[model samples]
Target: MDKQLLERVTQPLGHPSTSSSTTTGDTPGVNEPRRDYETGTGPSPQQRDAINQIFALLRYNYHNQFTKAFPDLEAVKTGKRLWLNLLAEYPADVLLKAAERAVKECTWLPNVHEIIVRCDLASSLGVPDSWNAYLEACRAPTPKREQRWSHPIVYLAGKASDWFFLANNIEEVAYPVYERNYAILLRRLLAGEALDLPMEKGLPDHVEHPLPRQEQQQRLRDLIADFDHPGRS
Candidate 1:
């Protein structure tokens, strides 16, 4: 987020010739900046410099500390390459924060892998706000009787699916509950069944029932019998 660093990375390359002097088979213009195949845009000079800056900062601040911690510590000759690889894998902010955290926590110089691990840990600390909001919305009351499904769970599942689509954080929010129940919920949605998700302490629990109480009891007994008898009907 550093303005100077951002400018350095994003500075535009010189324009290539708009002239038609060259023939169709001629080589590409030199002034035309090389495009990143993945992004289709020219790479920024600042991004390149930032990669070196990060490595330099780490070396300057922690080289001695690292040497003191490990007397046999070898010179990090490939630190720049390693750091550049890290930059490719992570955003600048994430790498910077990871480096800062490593510096604070490590007694010796930390390796690029260690900093990356720290970044992963930091990333896993919480779900995004959008996911949290979606979860919260799942807890909201269903619409009025005439306008909505009779079953709150069915309504919730529909809403949750819609929320997941909009959230862009399905991997974080969809887990043991959502992943497990998605198919069953989809069935209920398609069948127009009145879904009664078991509630615990006023919050939704995972038990889903598309059938009435008698049917559920019968199903439970049948399941128990099946378990007891193995392959028997």
Candidate 2:
């Protein structure tokens, strides 16, 4: 990740008192995270301005470079700044940890577990764009202050691989997403199939996001127990 990108990743986690007025559900966007970053919790006015500017830059970059549906950092908390240093500081671990937090404390939402497991797999497999594309399209969940659950984000770690994450209500319609996309990318790369994601964006090969396979469900539960609710273990 670029130094600038990581710099703009985090923000002080807050609730309805000072959050975006646009969101409705648990879908992820710019909101204060619930982490225990002392530095992130509160900051001086000068520091706040610097953080906000970074967020603005990130939002602009994310919208312009990625799809239009993607929300920028500004959409998080409107008044407070975040601790994005954590992103560059501990990118993958932080995300996984956040998921864990939601799992343990959050009143169960199967969809939440689904996104976490997907991200875990994507991180393990290294595929972020797949998740990004889907998130850019998925409707933002409602009940704003609730725990953030981004199905598209979980697997953003796997941008370099040949997988694109996708979601459908039925299981029977899953594998084809992964298989077809992988095949197309491979064919295109072998002999220019019209579109080939540039190498600069990591690697090119978009498979579908990990389906809610038995392993995913099981592992996600485990992630919640282990990372978020340690007491449960």
Candidate 3:
């Protein structure tokens, strides 16, 4: 990496050594200037340093003509602040990978948003490619009794019930309504009524329940009927 670019990137954040140093005085020390990274109960010193290094590398590469467009020092500082805010949610390695990808693919110097978009894409690449693969991956390694209810369908059903209750403002009779709707949805899901078109090509195209609208309506009707006749099956 070019030394000039490193200096430029580090100068705004007061350089890593100065930022991390314990010594304090009139001179520029770690404690002298409060940075966006240092404010508001942020990452540990090590994490802060790692994020700085990532910014330095990105800025260095951009200034070195790896990207056709380069951001000025102030723009880089502002962008770094935005990136640091995301560190709590996204892993540093993932963000680094995102930065690397942006640098490789984009002709212009990528902003924080562009890097974040790449991070989402990179993170999604780890997901199982097909629904079957996803189900297999979701299976618990240890066969615990509680793990039986940990299936994806159960989770989705719970979400669906919560959504329905909220959407319909069913506060007074939340429990029975939620239970009925959840069971109905779960039944449909188990009966192969929740599948979608295979997202990836070459996978089986004729999976049952290419769309779930019909099943959803049927289950909804069952829920409504249960509500209408509270004591009836």
Question: What Cα-based lDDT does every candidate model obtain?
Answer: 0.46, 0.36, 0.48
The true-versus-predicted C-alpha distance at residue 201 of model 2, in Å, is 55
Superposed model 3: Cα runs more than 4 Å off? 1-8, 11-41, 44-47, 64-78, 122-233
Best by lDDT: 3
Model 2: lDDT to the true structure: 0.36
Model 1 residue pairs with clashes: 8-46, 9-46, 9-47, 66-109
Q: After superposition, how far is residue 166 of candidate 2 from its true place, in Å?
A: 59
Evaluate residue 219 in candidate 2 and report its C-alpha lDDT on the 0 to 100 scale. 92
Cα lDDT tens digits for candidate 3, 1-233: 45675466455343334343332222333242322331223333333544677666665666654223334555455555556666544544455566677778888666767877866763353321112222332343433223433344433443455544434553324433443444454334434465222233476767775558988899989999999999895
- Per-prediction count of colliding residue pairs? 4, 36, 0
Best of the candidates, TM-score: 3
Q: Rank the candidates by TM-score, best first.
A: 3, 1, 2
Q: What is the model-wide C-alpha lDDT for candidate 3?
A: 0.48
Order the candidate numbers by lDDT, best to worst.
3, 1, 2
TM-score (all chains, Cα) for each model = 0.32, 0.17, 0.36
Model 1 TM-score, 2 decimals: 0.32
Worst-scoring 10-residue span by lDDT in model 2: 35-44
